[model samples]
Target: MDLLTYIFFAFLFIHIFKHIFNILTQKNHPPSPFAVPIIGHLHLLKPPLHKTLTSLSHHHGPVLHLKLGLRNALVLSSPSAIEEFFNTNDIVFANRPHALAGLHLGYNYTSLPWTPYGHHWRTLKRVTTINIFSSHSLSLSSRIRNEEIKHLVERLNVGFDESRAFKKLDLKSVFLELMFNVMMRFSTGKRFFEVGMDGDEKKRLIDTLTKILVPNTKMGLGDFFPLLTWFKFLKLDQKLIDLHKKRDDFLQSLINKHRNHDPSISTNDTTLMGTLLSLQKSEPEYYTEDILKGIISMMFTAGTDTTALTMEWAMSLLLNHPEVMAKAREEIDSKLQRKNILEESDLANLPYLTCIVNEALRLYPPGPLLVPHASSAECTVGGYRVPKGTIVMGNAWAIHRDPRLWEDPTEFRPERFAAGGEGHLGHGGYKFVPFGVGRRGCPGAGMAVRVAGLGLGALIQGFEWERVGGELVDMSEGSGSPTMSKLRPLEAMYRPRSL
Candidate 1:
């Protein structure tokens, strides 16, 4: 045999021998089902990946060690597993996996979500915590949130010329428009879609966002096998390059406009982009134009779909169960005096409404697996040794629906949260991690709750809603790369209430 053939045989033999030795000797490893050579357990992965992982967790255990290509993943489902990782190993597990999305959309692993846990990530987190997501910041934007919801109500009213007659409305589109308007107005000081805009322009913008977001949200093959990037078979690499150009170009325009913006402009007119631009002056080295764009892009992509989809699911669930809807409306009407709207400040007093929002969050979390966290060093979880650089994914969907943790796990019982002192706070511990529980958990959660509460409360208070054709709204979860949304766009009949 040739020298090359001899070396290949020796390498293969050593690889198989190590596998056999690890299986026989490494009892500290977490239980895993059989994995194939080279590809490992990648073949077992299916769409709506959380469900497949949950099934594996169910059969083997909550803490599972699986080989996903060359990478090792620790699948966590139970709250204990979550705590052990997020608490004991929080720092070590704070790093993110080397995702393809991070390479392109996350500004080369520098965005808040994909940035490694270090000084750089710390700075981004500080900006979000102190400047963006602070209670003061949310209060500052309350006017924008209220105004956008009112605009939505107006558009909904205009759609139905007849006062009391139900009109067929594509709620998915309505919610999307409202969310996009609110998100854009709050972040960029402009609206991508509004009345009197060129129809073609609006369509083009929507199509571009979809083209970027739809694929970014889904886990690409390039993520699992980097070698596939060499071949032109998947085309993910080319697609990402094209998308990054379009996205960066668009975001750059926003930054440039704000750079030359008037300083005397009111804070109400000043947006997240403007605020960041102002900060850039003080910390030019830290807050580069690229960082500014990354923050806004992350805000737009992360904030828009998640907020809109959560509201859509909440409404769908309420339509499927009307008694819960009546209870929520009554709670609002009794305490609320703002005509047909619920103020952002008013969200706290209405406990039942908050419960419904929390329930929806638990049932259909925007991100089922949350984001994949990686270990910077070796760690022990659930009495098993996990290697360094393991990708840790917390299955929020499974944990939220785990029967052991929650009573009637599959049932939509918001009262359970109310019965305890939880009341949408997700209780005292990690029992409910709708927005996830960790240092890297979603920072926009507080703002998200306010948006959902005000938007949903206004709809319930001002209108009468029912499923079209007197049928129930479908609650089947749709497969998404980023968020598990409803399989179908929500369509419902609505009419103005005789308030």
Candidate 2:
């Protein structure tokens, strides 16, 4: 044969051999629905992503795979599958996916929540656990929580009548302000939402944060399709850049204020920023300005809204089931006999109150789909191979409400979490993971539980809560956000309870 003919035949032989090799070596992947060209399963995605994934899992299997544009995704709605992945392959899947929000808002993925699992992440976790979320630290900060809860109670009590008439109030705003104030004080020893604070300053701070946070909750097209990032028409990346600039400026101002302040000024060293600043003086190489700002950003972005929304959901559930509310209040009243005010210490003794919180969390977890985790190495999950860089997300909402897992799963029964209840598992337990599970689980779970417990318990103890206008508070969930929020903000009528 001539040289040209030989080259063509050789190329054909190589191609055929390669195709056969691929067939032989292909890994066993999980079940997936039909995917289209280029877009893959993107067309299948709908709003309220958790519910969509749950339906897909039901149609497919618990371990369902999808090609989200260029990315590979695994959505697990089964507790057994979740346990297998998170337990057996915890460290392999500890890294976070590279998204637009992590690039900008997460300080280019160096922040605690976005950074890959490594020495830096370990160091960040240690610092936060020791100085912020440790039991000892939470105990030391109890007074701040107590004071903030008191402020919230006082603010809600304003404009009350002698007859204790029920007054309409927006509990969403109340809970948001309370959480922000609590987290801000923990970080900076300042309360931005308190009454008589500079109105313009509060507005600017809140506006800037709201602008940044709302976008972070969304998953942009660029996150799934990197090529789409080249088109400026998308504008999500540009918006994130602008928002991060504003956020950086605000955080820098706070750091500078703390940095330049006199050390003798009332022992500010106890504050989170102050503690980090002190560490900066000693370990300047490790704790850079970006690190400080990143930690602070994590404090607000990770800690605030989830706890706030949990409170809102808990209250909405309580309003819909006044019997549950009465039971919770009765437990608090009987436990704290004549104390009137619900204290942080009082929360430990309130088992029924704890059950109520657990039930609320089960019904509507803050992160219905826990934060996305990425696999760093190839691994097997549920007998299927999960390639490196595959994004795995546990549908906590589905697991929490799985009919197979709980009796009357849809019902808001707090007693289901009492002794021998299915929902009574401890943290890191796959069957009941509101705060996530395994190595990368939230270190601040203790603090979150305390703040949420104290806030909800106080509200139940101090108020005669009722649905506004005889209509049930809407229990619908919001869409396009990472955290599950109420579609309609919760508003209720309340009067001071007569103990």
Candidate 3:
């Protein structure tokens, strides 16, 4: 045979072999969207992504699989599907969704939220749970929180109008102040306004840092593409590095001050940074200084905004549904009438208040996506193959609003969590996973509940709240990574209630 004829035969054989291989691999996984070449589903996403995903869920089933460019994103929107994540295949979804925020908060992938499944993540989780988020730590911090709460009450009292019987106040700033002080005490053993900065500088610096940390714009192409991350188009990569450095410098300064304690002065049991430093001494390799800084940053990013956002939502919901608010207020006032202050133990008797908080969390989970989870190993869900390292996100918003799980899912009715109610917040209905589930669920759940419940309950007990401008509260949500807060700050008038 001629050499040209042999070459033609070889090319044809190779083409046929490639076709056969494609057909064989096609059977391994279920069908998905026709992902566009460069941008997959980027154009399909609408404003308020939660609503869009909810609509898509009805059409695509509970566990809809899709591609976000070469990246894979599985949108799980049902109780059963989420149950599979928490109970059946918990270990499979142990990793986190690799996003810009995770990397930023995790300090270049050192923290738990951004770390992949393995020794590093497991060690971090264990240390955090035992040393930082334990019940003992929370009880110890109660005195500190009470001190801050006292200041909050004093500020509100001074803000109230003595002549008019009611005065307008912006609850957002008040809550922000309270949370900022609390987090500062926990992080640096000092307050930003108290020790770090004076006059307007404190507020200005905090505001600027907050804006940089939580930018509204979509992350540059680097975050998603990974390959082009080194490119400097929007200066995103450089900006993050700069922000990290700034934050680290501030945190380290605080740490150094704590280290150089005066012999004459005594300190409280030890701050979060102190504990992290102690941990660093033992596990030098894993718990390095950078890792400690990342943990502090994560706590700040996760803690402050969400707690205040919940307060805004709960207050707004109570005002809108006067009956629920009235009932809750009555219960709190009656129960705590004798005591001058509200206690965490009082929370158990106030089931209705608990229900209301649950409902708020359901309607407006602080973290809409719940710190994305990644696949540790190759797995399949709802007949789709998910290879290892694929980023997975549970649509907490869609699951919370799933009609099949709750009656009138969109409505903010706290009755659903009452005794014999259809869907209790915890346990069975995995749909209302505001704190997420599985081993990596928010370790600060107990502290969050106590602080949120006590703070909000205090507001209800101490004052009668109403819209300041004689307008109804707008229930629209604001945009943010991790936390979906109120777009418009909740402004209200306060009138001290008669005992």
Model 1 compared with the native: what TM-score?
0.88
lDDT of each: 0.77, 0.80, 0.68
Query: In model 2, where do residues sit more than 4 Å from their true spots?
Result: 1-25, 197-208, 230-236, 262-267, 426-429, 479-499
Better of 1 and 3 by lDDT: 1
Model 2, residue 235: distance off in Å is: 4.8
lDDT of 2 by residue, 286-391 (tens): 8999999999988888788788888888888888898988888778878876455788999889988888888888889989998899999888766798888998
Please state the error at residue 288 of candidate 3 in Å.
1.9
Q: Which candidate tops lDDT?
A: 2
- Measured with C-alpha atoms, the lDDT of residue 431 in candidate 1 is 69
Which pairs of residues have clashing backbones in candidate 3? Answer: 95-374, 96-374, 97-372
Candidate 1 residue-wise lDDT, 215-254, digit = tens = 4555566776665566564486777778888889977876
Q: Which rank order by TM-score, best down to worst? A: 2, 1, 3
Greater lDDT among 1 and 2 belongs to 2
Candidate 3 residues 1-499, lDDT tens each?
Answer: 9754764465456545644664587544534455554556666678677777767777877776665644667777777878886567888887776767557655767787678778988888887777668887787788777777755654455533445355555556556667777887776666645532343775675576565443342444556566445445546567667666667786566566666773322234377877887777888886777788767776776677778778777777777777887898788867876356556668888888888888888898877766667787877766667777776667888878777777898898988888888766444668678898887788777777777787877777666666655566778776332212221211232334321
* Candidates arranged by lDDT, highest first: 2, 1, 3
* Candidate 3 segments whose C-alpha is farther than 4 A from its true place: 1-24, 28-31, 99-105, 159-164, 194-206, 212-220, 230-236, 262-269, 282-286, 479-499
